[model samples]
Target: MPTQLLSAEQSTALGTKPHYAILDGLRGVAALMVVVFHLCETHATSHLDQVINHGYLAVDFFFLLSGFVIGYAYDDRWNGMTLKEFFRIRLIRLQPLVVLGMLIGAALFYFQASPAFPAIGQVPVWKLLLVLAIGCTLLPVPLSMDIRGWHEMHPLDGPGWSLFYEYIANLLYALGVRKFSKTALAALVVLAGAALIHFAVTSKGGDVVGGWSLEPTQLRVGFSRMMYPFFAGLLLSRVATLSRVKNAFLWCSLLLVLVLAFPRVGGAEHLWLNGLYDSLSIVVLFPLVVWLGASGHIARPGTARLCKFFGDISYPIYITHYPLIYTYTAWVSATRPTWQQALPVALLTFVTAVALAYACLKLYDEPVRKWLRRKLPVMQ
Candidate 1:
């Protein structure tokens, strides 16, 4: 809760800023895995499909990583900085590219031969602008523009739903809930209630593996499902501050727990079961990630570069992938006899997503972030 210790740690590290490369590499792995999972939705085998569905668990990883990274980066700032400053820093870091992606996406929808958008004469200009405006801001405008469920993109950006949660989570953290015991307790209670709700909902539908029946609405509810993982990370941040393991066996045991809990490549029968698996996965992964970070593994030259690069472009890839995937799939479907008939389309879509992510990172994300940083200074 005090600022002095954190400030000292930061100053000492700044001569060479603490590099969390392993975490970055982990991020790259997570993002790419999600892409593969989504791509394989149509053809993957039972075991593989089970594991692939678990790919959605990557969102948990992101939330955990966010908690750890924010704690690592701004713990010092937290002690001294006002809530406004904290919020401003997050905006500067996260908002610009989001806006750019939405604008570009909107344009693509406007001109493309897709049925997703209204024709020029019939365009609801004010409604469209309103969607963009609210979307570009921190507010979650799901029902405002008749956007009812998850995956409803205003023409272009599909990953917008996750961003909504990310923003909300960040706001709660910045507001100093992370420092409050009551906040943490409340989070746990909410998570328990959510787990119960998921169990009830999933059980009534009957337990069948193959024909997945969770609605888009059910999946949307899963977003609230993330608070558990986030708090778990917070709890681990505190746990990590304790005495180190006395033996290699202890660390090994922790590692084993993590792996065992990971939703075994595709085994969960329902969202509730999935939630249990995910919670275990985070608990296991969080400590390992922290230990790796603290031990200087992330600072290894090659590993550091890989992590930093992925972490930088990770958001763009997440936000832009659906459109890129859809567009690529559509083109392949039109040109070829059967889109899924060719393996090349999947590979091509992946390559294109990575390329566009890199471009967005370089052309829009970094520059706008820097400009915003200059425009609204973050307290040191």
Candidate 2:
């Protein structure tokens, strides 16, 4: 996820810019859905029957938001900023939590040794630390280095795969894509959208879900998943005219939840049906939601505070929640508990994830980013 909208303090410290408060709130909404999606995933026998089926699309939505935010925040500033400076600013915004997420994963690594993650118990300390070190850098490990048996690029934190792609998108933007003419960028988006549809509809599973691995097929899924939404958002930012919409945040958030929580479109016999749904949602619905969100303004103090809280915790929760999920998944797999049995713990996990994320944000993320900006005067 790109650090799309900055907090009031951050914007003031850097240079004041108008806030997309509703977009920030929508991001927080998506991030929470991702947690719920993963929690519900532990109970799913397969993706076909998974609860919050399209929650994976939140990552795609994030890419879209990232593109819009990057374009809005930095597209014009390149005249004054070097590529290295841009990368450094991004790293300062993103890398601190990435390191903390990996650290949390490593701290809880041994606790999650149930049947669900059979390999965790057997991983040597040296090897585990090695992965931890690499994961802290947000670099993808090879499949041979898969210590969790899930074959995730970063076994310590599976979601790091998306962040890896986030970095790639940032790199591409800095290197050349940022310089593309509007027409050129739109053409690239069309091609990328075509690729996304092809992968989603034609896949054996009929979903664009296998991007965490390093294999060729997975790599295609990864790139296809990233390209269209990011560029589309970028394009939208450059071209779309904003009109103030009343209750836009509520309407957009509800739209996001409806699309994301909508049930599987076609069941076992018609896999491509869900793929088509996936493509449509990403290609059409997400951008609409983003446009509406961008058009919104916070009209009340209570609503404004809610949006700010959600925006502040959004990234931290997304990056750090999965480690808790690893433990919860292990418990579910090993125990096979009924919903009644698991409800309390599930609620606890949700609450704890939110609490921990907020704690990390206030205690670590804010302070570290502040220190970095101070040390690197160029960021200021």
Candidate 3:
């Protein structure tokens, strides 16, 4: 919301940088789409028929944004900042919500017991507590710890898998990638792009729609999905030139929705076609949107407020929304309700997710971060 990624004290110590208001707004747009995508996912028999067909790409877009933001915020700061400091900042920003999301999932775990999550009823209280404790640390639990039977690394909160990968990306950048020269970074980006294409187009399922588990194959999917957009975003930040794009937020948001909500590119016969679509979206389209959003300006107070609001809650909603979706999925699985019949509940779920995210943001995340900033010498 403040445009600079740093806290107020840190921003003062370091000079303030311009905030990408439009990019923040675009992130919110994608976050909302993700919620819709997950909701619609329950109704689809498979990826081929899923409504909001490309919503999974939002994760890739998020990676890109994270790279861009990390570069923008910290690329120049290593001269003064230690890796410990950087990790502390990231954990302060991210971990509180991770803990809360897992707690919410644990709280709602039993209620979600249905045909879809067959193991939920059978999971003992001790196992649930163990999973919750591991989840609070953002560590991946093994398959034997998967009490939900979905094979998620964090079965209590499925979306925690992405956060696990996100931390890996942060560690990679902090440890070595941040030091790469521009030419070397470009080479890395190109190779990552190739891996992404190979995985998306060659996989039997098609599309870059995985990365939620810890198995060898799923690990491949996860890394392939992460490497490109993130480093591409980092490269773009280094090399990008800015020019004003009028109404950039509006146009970029529209394009993002169009691509994400577009129908599957090829049906069951041509899985690779959808995979190609996924590749193009992450490899080409997502960065374009980020560039445009970065280049644009907010002309009106109302629009500025809108972007700020969306940007502020974007991460909170994303990290918290899926637990509700797990419940919705269970409901849909048990009842097999038609779209019309389920429409109201789905809408309510969406609203509830939004409200819950905002509540967590104000009631917990902000206060905790403020406390961390004051108490942690690194943040100070």
Candidate 4:
């Protein structure tokens, strides 16, 4: 692994700004926050749960950061890189570890249903097939055939839905159709309008369906919402880089939008208060977070190595932790019979998630990333 990332002085020595450490650090922070949120939900810790509920907003943060990172990382390649090469790199980075997580989740589900376990005496063949297909394709469809259905199962992690949109954003970027200013702007507008409509339907006490609801319109709307923020991020990246004034204005505008927008869109009472926090997390926090990550303060004296380590494993942890957390919760609920009694189990789940995440990074993610880089050779 690369040691401490380039500092300002080091970047100056090299005659350009390196990608920001502060941003990666923010990613680190975001990942850990999600972990805490997951654990809190499992443990039924009201205090931590309230504080960390905004962690889902980190999905938007990730999406925005993806826009910024993709722009910054590949700015040079815009004219030169082929769509095929773009996808090859992207697929290799995402697929292997995600597949592993899905596989593990399937195994656990199967184990729960196994005759040997006795607690669960073999799942229906149709249920097994649904999970197998979903895991193998790495494509999530809101199918009705699954045991828990789309609403109840979560297959791997419910958050895994975001990755589907993330890939779609990447694919759209690769298509070169978005390069034309007029076309890009129109597409973004349409996408944004669709997102607003979806938000309205959901937030205004309308019965808007979604992936969880296993309704096709809802699923499409859900996917559209993810796309909008990503495009917004892209548009911001483009204009913000042009001048300091524009950057400030863009940031301010985003803040204003969030203030005027989130309350109308986030419907649940549980979500209403945290909704603003999560909204600003992406709209406002992303730029600031990126700035901090790049500043090299992440590795400062007081920062814990364990947190950084967790940050390193954050992606895998996100992918794998959900099932374990759920299973752990289920086991505790069955055996110990109380939320208070489940606390220790939740803690154990946290530790196990960290360990498994590290292992995935070491055994799967890092090697596959290296292999993809060599095989694709986009940079050279």
Predicted structure with the largest lDDT when compared to the true one: 2
Please give each candidate's TM-score: 0.72, 0.97, 0.97, 0.73
Ranked by lDDT from best down, the candidates are 2, 3, 4, 1
How many clashes show up in model 1?
Answer: 4
Candidate 3 Cα deviation (angstroms), residue 75: 0.8
Global CA lDDT of candidate 2, please? 0.89
Model 1 C-alpha lDDT per residue in residues 166-226, reported as the tens digit of each score: 7777777777556767456456736744663454346432211211113354444544445
Off by over 4 Å in 2: 1-14
For each candidate, C-alpha RMSD in Å? 6.7, 2.5, 2.0, 6.9
Where does candidate 3 stray beyond 4 Å? Answer: 1-15
Show the colliding residue pairs in model 4. 20-294, 21-293, 21-294, 22-292, 22-293, 22-294, 23-293, 23-294, 113-122, 209-218
For each candidate in the order shown, give its overall lDDT on alpha carbons.
Answer: 0.54, 0.89, 0.88, 0.55
> lDDT tens string, model 2, 1-380?
11234553336434856668888889899999999999999999999889999899999999999898888878878778888888878888889999999999999999999999999878999999999999999889999899999989999999999999999999999999999999999999999999999989989988888789898989999999999999999999999898878888899999999998999989989999999999999999999998988887777777777888899999999999999999999999899999789989999999999999999999999999889878875544
Q: lDDT (0-100) at residue 266 of candidate 1?
A: 27
